[model samples]
Every structure is written in structure tokens, then in C-alpha cells.
Target chain A: MTIGEVRENPAPAASVVRQPTFVVEPSKGWLALNLQEVWEYRELLYFLAWRDIKVRYKQTILGAAWAIIQPFFTMVIFSLFFGRLAKIPSDGIPYPIFSYAALVPWTFFANGLTQSSNSLVASANLIKKVYFPRLVVPISSILSGAVDFVLAFIVLLVMMVYFDTLPTWNIVWLPLLLLLALVTSLGVGLWFTAMNVQFRDVRYAVPFLVQAWMFATPIAYPSSLLGEPWRTLYGINPMVGVIEGFRWALLGVNTAPGPVIIISSLVSVGLLVSGAFYFRRMEKTFADVV
Target chain B: MSDVAIRVQNLSKQYHIGGTQAGYKTLRESLVEGIQAPFRRARKLLRGQATGAAELDETIWALKDVSFEVNEGEVVGIIGRNGAGKSTLLKVLSRITEPTRGRAEVYGRVGSLLEVGTGFHQELTGRENIYLNGAILGMKKAEIERKFDEIVAFAEIEKFIDTPVKHYSSGMYVRLAFAVAAHLEPEILLVDEVLAVGDVAFQKKCLGKMGDVAKSGRTVLLVSHNMGAIDALCETTVFLEQGKVVDIGQTPVVIQQYLSSLYDIADYSLQNRVDRGGSGRAKINYIYLATSDGLPLQQVLSGQEVMIVIGYESQIPLNHPTFKLTVYNNVGQPLTQFDSSLTNALFIQLPLRGYVGCQLGKLPLSARRYRLHASLDNGVELLDHWTGAYSFTVGPGNYYGTGRNVVGLKDVCLVDQTWQLLENAPEVHWSV
Candidate 1:
């Protein structure tokens, strides 16, 4: 959305007082998202992410072990219900590795979305007193979830080795795919968190939404069942592209995800851009009613 | 002009009166309204109604047409009674909340101490909280690192720096919190009434730091109920009344004008004063001067027999309730106190809702206006701690029963004593 001006200025103005470092009023119209302020406070982003990671693990007997435990057990349940019982097609790869691969990124997206969606309300204390980019709250909440993603990824790699599936040169596409997952997570997070500020019912609705979203993605079954045009049409749900791309990158799957990636990428970028603008619109009113 | 650090133009903030429910409506109410909106409109049309009944939400202007400017390196004081929009103005300037009308242009980096320890984590160590709290207050990482040792020394918590802040005593927590705030260096600083809390020594240390900040030539916009601090540090003071800017000028004159207005607020019944504290076991209904024969008097005279009666209402009987009445001059300085417990004054079981009076042999002060702070403690808990419960002026009179009037300028109160002057020099060698 910020193809225009994107700064709430960090002017080093020694001479121009009238130019003013900032002008405070009830923001009118569609203003820039002030991403420049977000960049200036990057260290706060790190500290907040660090705080979340540290505090979540503290005083728990399992600690970061829960990070691996959560996705692994969920994968086991999927392999049982979808793979063994339902005879769900998995593109000829082992279903455990198949589900585990998707679970790594899927867990990251789901937890990140849930945490970031609730982040603003949980940080009401900081919001009411201080002035900072409210964007930092949801972003840092997402960043903290990446730690668990990495830990879970290590387990997925170990599972991959056991299953004898290897990666190809397509692995280079992994970073963009992970980024797409994050953008999608943050996009939906911004919308829902902003809405949660207005309507607390969003909090109760999130887990249900996440559960439905996971099933909508191709985690339990391959997208190949729906033939050709419909198969590609299914990529309207963005995570389909992410999960399929991950499979193509790691397992050297024959289907290259052609139109699915294109459609999904377009949809995701749209979600992010619009989500940012909507978030900026709601940002001014947060402290007043938070 | 470049020298103008802050220019506020008719800045205002309006809040809905029953705002918590009105502004933050539950999703069910919103959903129901959304679904029923067309029907409601149709029903209104059928009834031939022209008014918009749904738009009947109440609102209040916390700040209205508030405009002021602070020159570069000037310390400006904001003074007002409770709910006078003082804190709202500071919040708007600090950008914590946006103004609904107009705007303010702040020239430099803003640091606000609206409340100390703004984002301190209780689970974190004192050391971690300093860095985290500093960062939240807009200090950079290196800035906090450079001042790390200084902050620790300032808080005097070197030994407990690594311990979790949750374990700290309340006093230590406040000290550490103020320490981080004291170290924040911004181009413009907006300080709220942070000095009102903390112990005597802590308040002095905080005041000393505030004075240092004022002398450092940075622009400062300060809001405080402490007139003494406002007068000591600020060159010009802005007086606010009922959400509007009432006066702004040289500090002394504005403070005098603000204090004079305190007398106007005294006429309101304490039942609705709103500015009071303590547990709600009992409430001070009103307080006024009374003649010895128990008729109410508007004012008293020095060297005259006077009685002050306190009216109160309580849910339960006050058990031998100890009462304290403190007198403060118009400048908010405590002048004298009459405490019942200290004097061993006896009382039977006090009625739940009734009057109690303390008789004075002679009015102790002369020729000045004074306010009263009356408090009741029912032995178990404080029932009321009402400041400025009443105010009256004493006419010039001979406090010592002398032929001349007592001058109140040199002291707060006058005491009686006979002076023989020891004309013989007392050289009778009683010590030897």
C-alpha cells in the first residue's frame, strides 16, 4: 500500500522547527504505514521477540521441547487419520515425511498468526503509555515463532533422511516460500489483531479459523486429486502454494506448482498490502480505546 | 520560528462519557446492530420519526481548545485541579493519544514520563528492565548501555541488579523505575506528576534530577499538581480549568490565580467533589466553621473561640475513629494540624452518619486564607483522606490577646508566650 510516502519522519532537523519531527492529530484519510519508524525501532523488535521466546520457555519443565512436541504429535495424528485410515494420496512420498514437512511451515504460520493476532491486546499496557509503531507488536510476535519453526525444521530434516527423500536445486526457492508464509501470517495477523482491538470475539474465533485454514491447505492430501484447472484454481487459498512449493523444493515432486504459485503469490501480496493500509487506518484510534 | 519547540493549535480530545461500553461494544451488540439496522431504519420511518435516536451517545471534552507554545529550551508548567485536562494535554503532546481536533508540532525527539517503569517486566532482572524500559521509552540500545552503570548507581540497586524485579520491595522498585526515567535524554521532555509518589528522599532526588533537566536548556513541558515544584522549575505556567486554558503567564501570577480559584471549588459539597482518596468505609459529607453555640459560621477570627464541625456518612459505626485535621495555606503548604489521637481525645462509638466538632480556645492563625485536610481512620483502615475539605479566611485579630495584629507573613501560625526579657541577664550562677 505504501507505494507513496512511508515515513512518520525521523528528521534530524536542527534548523527547521516548523518542519516538525512529527505532527499529532487524529489521522485523516489513507496515510502511509510509517514503515520507516518500524525500521528505526528494529532493536525494540529484537528485544521484544527475545522477551517472548525467553518468557515462553521459562518455568516450564519441557521448555523449548514443546516446540518440537506440538508439531510432531500433530503430524502423527494426521498420518494416522489421513494417511493410514483414509488412504489419502501423498504424491508417492511417505505420508509421515509428507505431513511433517508441511507441519513445520504450517506450525510456524498457525502459531505466528495466533500469537500476533492476540499480541496487541496482550500488550495493552505498553500501548497505553508509550509511542511506538504498533506494527512492531504483531511483527515481533511473528518473529518469535520462527524460533520454534527452526527447531521443528531440524526434526523434519531428520525425518527426511530416514525416509530417503532428498532435496534438489529447487531448495533455493525455500526462503521466498518461507517469506510468503510469514507475509500471509502477518497479513492475516494485522487484520485480525486490529479487529480484535475492536471486537474481542476475534480471539475466540482465531483457533477455529486456524483449524479450518489448515484443512483448506494441502497438508493432509496432495492437491493433485482435483484435475488440472481446478487443481490450479485451488491455489486461491495461498497456503496451497506454500505447502506445494515446499514439497516441490524438498521432495523433487514432478508437479512444479506453475500457475498455483503465481495465483497464490498475487493473492498473498494483495492481502499484505491491503492489510497494512487497514492497520494504519486503525492505528490512531488504538490508544484512545485500547 | 526554529526556536519554537512545541506549537499546539487548538488541540482537543473528546471522549464518550460511558465510553468503555459505547466505544468498545461487544461483538454481539455490533453483529446484532448490523443485522437489524435496515429494519430499525424502516421502523423509524413508519413511526414518522425524524430524530436519530441511535446517535444519543454522551461525550465529554477532556481537552477543549487548548493552545500553547514553548520556546526552545524553555520549561513550561501545566497546573490544574483533578480532571482539569492536564494529563490529557501531556498525553497528546507526548503522542500517546491523538488529538481529535487540531494538531501539535514538536520540534525534536520526545520523551515522556507519564508513568515510571512504563514497560518494565516483572520477571526480568533489574538489569534487564533498565534496558527494556529504556528502549520502550525511546532510548537506543547504545544509549542505554552507556548509561547502564550510571542508572544502576542512581537507583542504588547494584547488588540486586541481577535479581528479578518481582522480588524487589515496592520502594526499591519505584527507585529503579525512576532511575531509568531520570536518565532518558530527549530533545523535548514531557513529565507528568511523577514526583507525587515515592518517599521523601526519593522525591528530593527526583526533584533534583528534574531541576537538572530544566537547567540543561532542553525544552520541557511539565504537568504537576505540586505548585512548589512548578514555581521552582518553570519560568512560565499555564493554568487549566475544566478542560480549557484559563491562564498562562509568569509562574507566580498564574499560580496565584490558580490557587485563588481553589476557593471557588470549595463551595461544592464534598459529596460530589470527586477529588478524594482512601477506602470507602466512611465519607466526609462536609466541613465548616461553627460558633461555640453550634451555629454555622462562614469564617472565623483570630483570638476568637471557634469550633470546626465535620459531617460524615458511613455504612458501619466508626470505632473510636481517630480524626486528623491539617491546615494548609493557600499555596498548598501545610500550616498546622489538630490530631485527635495524638491529643488522647476520647469519643464513644461514633454514629454511622452524623457530625463531630472540635472546639478551639482561640483561632491560632491570622489574616490569611487557609484550606483544610480532614481524614478519618477507624482503627482498622483509613475511612477518608479528603484534602481541601474546607477553606476559610481569618480576619486580622490579636492572636496573643495583645493590642496589635499578628503578622502571618513571617510564620504559618502564632503561639502565645510572655516575654519578661530576663532583664537581669540571669547571672545568678545557677549553672555553677
Candidate 2:
């Protein structure tokens, strides 16, 4: 009955400790996105990502080869439909290399979005049972996609060699383009992930969203077909810049990336910031609702 | 340098109750509610009412104004009945869920074992899962690496470490998971009923490890229904009832208080108790404890005559109805059951409404609080089943007439026994 009267004392022993104290309470105002806490849990993030990568390829016949096969097959299908059937222009580059280049980052973005959006629900066990930065779940899912992207990138290089269309020095911009793709995926993925926790309809909607988004991006076709303002507006879908930038950089395509890249970069960063805030807002409710 | 490993002040968690749907609302329910919101508001406005029964505020506080402080190197036990918010308190302190009001501050690296192997992937190998589960429990990779060999050796699964966990037997899987958790080495540990799994030896090992952890000057908060473990391990105990702390003191005193409270409910009316389940063709009305001579009894001594009177009603006539009365110990483990059908008393006709009494010549249970669960069923169909329908206390008595009392006995039951010794005949039995 006198539990409240218990006096606090200094910890005994002379060992130096680095643990930080924390206060848990209901959200009162705009919560800070404690990036420091997430940084401290960075090792957990690495293990989680490693687990996802290992589990994805476990008990499989093709193993990591499946990563390459997914985008390669999608590229074949897009080439047949858009290039051979619809006669869609590819800015004078071979259609296979053009679409394959776009699909490399596109697959990474799509897979990252789909996986990260469901990451919280999928790891509901850990979310409810243990305390960790919930952001680790979605971030690890996105990070795992980087492995798939790297594997598919090697195949993209092979395709470029086969098509006899090598890249110019523009390929130096590939890492920046990959980073943009990552940011864009994580931003939108965070929003969908948080929403998925409340309404599971987001889970079923993600695949359709990815499919619709792929069409909206200029994967099978060139963005050059659109005019100036429309092309600029098309960059509202951040993958437009990523895919266009990939084509421009990898295949030495003539697609102008100046205004669209700026618009898409701004959009990607904007989505990242806003989505992170929204995700953090819903973060406290996740353990209860999930 | 704060010695208070955990401090909770006025911490509470509110959960909505009494609705057609509860907790997580599915999309369909939300959609329907969304569509009907305007009409519901209009009706409320017309009635000059500000709220409805289905409003979100129709809530029950699982933990209300609870305040507790755990000092360094203290192993505190939280003892309470089911739904007493013991788990909720641990969950709040562990930061798995945010408290609805007030705050809880933990001054150390808190490792919570709310469940063992929480994030273990069945498809991953045992070695891989160790790293994964350790990380999920907030252990750094280097920490896990340092303890990897120790964990594997402790689990005794070194031979099968490379095999996927899904292929391991249930026991092996649990051992590996528990080994990783045991090596977490957090400054504060919060465990909730995780010892209920695994075999007896493994549980003993876990308890020993927990004891060592406590002795190493780290704080531990354990929530368990096992009075034996609580009495053995905890220096202090907190008893909760209906979201409020009823007692907080030495372990033996609090546990005794908890046990005594169980005997306070002499008669339980089963009519409106919503925790019952079954087809509802027949429903239990009321249950009471009595003596063999039909005298109402509240508490009886062990090995004394006792009877359980069950009043029930059936919508239709039941033939050869089986009535089962199961008794469980204080920790929710079923001690024994008495089934009418199991005996030779079969093919008995039952009226639409009547009272059925099960008379025991001598209650073989030891001195402890026990729960009664009753069910009325036909051979073909279940009519009604009430869990925790009633609870009673069995005080100690000299069942064998040995002039010795078994009050405060820890064993579950008492058995009659006799021993005889042959005088002066066993001196030459040592031939090799």
C-alpha cells in the first residue's frame, strides 16, 4: 500500500554504463521522430534486413537467381507488349535495355513498397511482444530490397552488353538515382505501412497499387513522348524521375532529365518527410491496434 | 545513476467494452460505421444526448492509477487473478504499448521476455534465429556474437545448429529460444508467464538463471500465477484486483491476502456471468458449496465432506445428461474432475429445471484456493460450460488421523497412506 513511498537510490556498483533512460507516455503533442533512438537500434535493423534476405531465398531452387529472373521476365513481357505490339518509342535505344534498366530500379521500388507496407503487420508478433523502434520493421524491409536491386543490376549490365548499347559517363549518376529510388519507396511505403496497421485493406491494395504505379511510370515507354509541363507534372510520381534517370544514365537515352529530375527529387524528399511524420504519429497506436 | 530501475505513476490503460465489435475493427465494420455516423449523430442530437452506448469512451481501465517503484537488484512479483492487469502493467513498463495516462520511466536497458522467441522465423536455421531473436530482444549484434557459443552450448543443440528451427522438435526450439533470451544481459528484465512452457528441468534452469540475474544487481519484475515460484524467488509482491493494487508487501503476506480473497465469494450466480461458453441449450443458474447433509458451506477443511450444488435449466428435456465438475488449483492448473458419465450412474432422466449435487466423501485437495468449472452436456451435444464458475478454499485437516495438520501445504493433493516396520528382522540383509 505504501508503494509510492519507496525512496529512489543511486545504482550500486562502480561499473560504467551507457544505457539511456526513457519515459513512456501517451502522445501529447507532435512527437519528435527520435532518429537517435533508431540510430542506436541500427544493429537490430541490420539483423532484421539480413533475416529478410536470408528467409526470402531459403528453400528455393534458383535462390538469389530469382531476383534477376523477376525483372528479366517482366522486361521480356513489357518489350513484347509495348515495343513489338504497341510500337511504343524508346528514344532510339533498344527497347529491351531501356525497359530493363527502368525495371531494375522499378522492381526495387515496387518490392520495397510492397514489403515495407506489410512489414508491421507481418512482424506483429515482435511489435506486440518486444519494444524496439517500429521504424526498424519498415526500414529493414526497404533495405532488403537493395540486395535484390544489386542482383538485378548485374543482369541489367549483361543485357546492355548483349544489346551492344553501353552506358556513357552518365552512369556515374546511378548511385544518386538509386538513393532517390530508395527515398521515394521508403516515404510512400511508410504511409502505406502505417495505414495498413489500421485497415488491412491496404495489404490487398498494395499489389494493385504497385501495378497501377508501374503503368503510370514510363517503364515500357519513354517520357519524351509527353510535352514540357505534362512531363514536369509526371514527375509527381517520383519513380518517373528514377526510371527516366536510369534510362538516361544507363542506356544513353535522349530523355531529358533536367526539370523532371528536379520535380521528382523534390517530390521524393517531400514524401519522405511527410510520410515519416505520419508514420511516427501512428507509431504509438501500432502496439495497441496491432 | 538512478537506482530505481522502473517507476510507474498513475499509469492506466483503457480498453473499449460492450459493443457488437471490439478491439481491432475490420474494414467492413469501419465502412458501415462511417456510413451510419451521420444518422447516429442526428439521432443523438434529436434525443438531446451527447453520447451513445457504442461511443468509444465506453471503456474499462485495465490499470487505473497504479504507482510502483522497483529499486535496483529487486525481484518483484506481480500476483493477481486473470484480467487483473498484471500483464498490462508489465506491458506498459516494457514500453510495448503506451499507457493511456501518466508515465513509466525505466532507468536501465530493459529487456522484456513477454514471450520467448518472439521474432524467431521458423524457416531460419537455429544459429540464424539466435541472432535474429537476440536482436529482436534489443541485444546488439556484437553482444549476441560474444554469447553465441555460450547460447548454443547452453541450448545443447550444437549438433543441429545448422538445421532450420522448423525442423527442430518443440522442446529443442524452446530451449534454443530461451537460451538466447537468457543471455540478453540487460540491466532490467521483465518476464510475464514465460516459464509456463518447457519441461520441469528446463523451468528449474530458467529459474536458476533468473535468480542469478537478480543476484547480479539487476532488477527483475516477474508476473506469474505460480505462487510457489513467486514465494521462492521474489522478495516483494504486489497483488492487483480489478485494475487496482490491493496489497504491496512481503511475498508471503501478499500471497496469503490473495488466497484469502478467493474464499470471499461463497456463492456465484452463473446466470449473468458472461465468461461462460457453450451452445446455450442449457444454462447454469447458480452454484454453491455445501456439506454432504445439505448444509450450506463457505469454507471447509481438507479431507472434510463437501458437496457442489449446481442449479441449471434446460429448454428441452435432456436424457442421460452428463454433468462434469472440474476443480483447478489457484494457478489455473486443473487438479481433477468428476464426471457423472464416467461413473456407473448413467441413463438418468433430467427434468427441465433442477439442482444437481455432487457429494464428495472427503475432499482430497490440499490447503489452497481452488476454482470450479462445470458443464452440462448430453452424450451427443454440449449444452453449457462455465469456466471459473465458482471458487472455494480448502483449509488443512488431519485426513489420516495422524494428529498433524497440513495447513499451508504446498502440494496439490493428499493421499491416504500407511507404513509398517518389522522389528529386529532387517539386521542381516546386507549380503553381497
TM-score of every model?
Answer: 0.74, 0.74
Compose the digit string of candidate 1's lDDT tens values, residues A1-290.
Answer: 00012213233376442588888877666668879989999989988898888688877899999999999999999999999999999999999998888988999999999998999899998988888899999999999998999999999889988999899899999999999999999999988887677557789999999999998999988899889899999988889999999999998889999899989898898888888887777776677656
Candidate 2: lDDT of B335?
80
Give the TM-score (vs. native) of candidate 1: 0.74
Residue B356 lDDT in candidate 2 = 73
**DockQ for model 2?**
0.49
The residue-level lDDT of candidate 2 at B120 comes to 92
For model 1, residues B344-377, the per-residue Cα lDDT tens digits are 5776588776667788998988778887898988
Clashes of each: 0, 0
lDDT of 2 by residue, A92-197 (tens): 9888888899899999999999999999999898888999888889999999988998899998888888889878799899999999999999999998998777
